[model samples]
Target: MKFLFIAQRKLVILRNQDFKDINPERQIEITRHFGPIHIHPTSGECQGGSPSSR
Candidate 1:
């Protein structure tokens, strides 16, 4: 699942999962294809001035 990777990138990595060491910008590029990324409520503004969905 795509969400698993996104969450893993922030939280913990599970055994047997392929880990990617990507920069934030590159991460966005990869994830954008899955649709808009979710930002935390307190994270403030994201790329292009888009506010957090929360």
Candidate 2:
């Protein structure tokens, strides 16, 4: 199954983690353990410096 996760204000697609097999109660518990996902900003090309600087 595919899951849509919002990370850093972006939509990320997650697939095939066997989420369906787990019960609803356990699913909520498992999801709470997940940390904040960070996604790089997709703007222009990065030069010699870090992308975050740009």
lDDT values for all models: 0.60, 0.50
Please state the error at residue 44 of candidate 2 in Å: 41
Off by over 4 Å in 2: 1-7, 10-12, 35-54
Span of 10 residues, lowest total lDDT, candidate 1: 45-54
Local distance difference test, candidate 1: 0.60
What would the per-residue lDDT of candidate 1 be over residues 1-54, giving only the tens digit for each residue? 877877877643457744266545666676677677777777776445553332
Worst 10 residues of 2 by lDDT: 45-54
Q: How many residue pairs clash in all the candidates, one count each?
A: 0, 0
Candidate 2, 1-51: lDDT as tens digits: 223346445555568688776764565556556653233676544334442
- Candidate 1 residue runs with Cα over 4 Å from true position: 1-20, 43-54
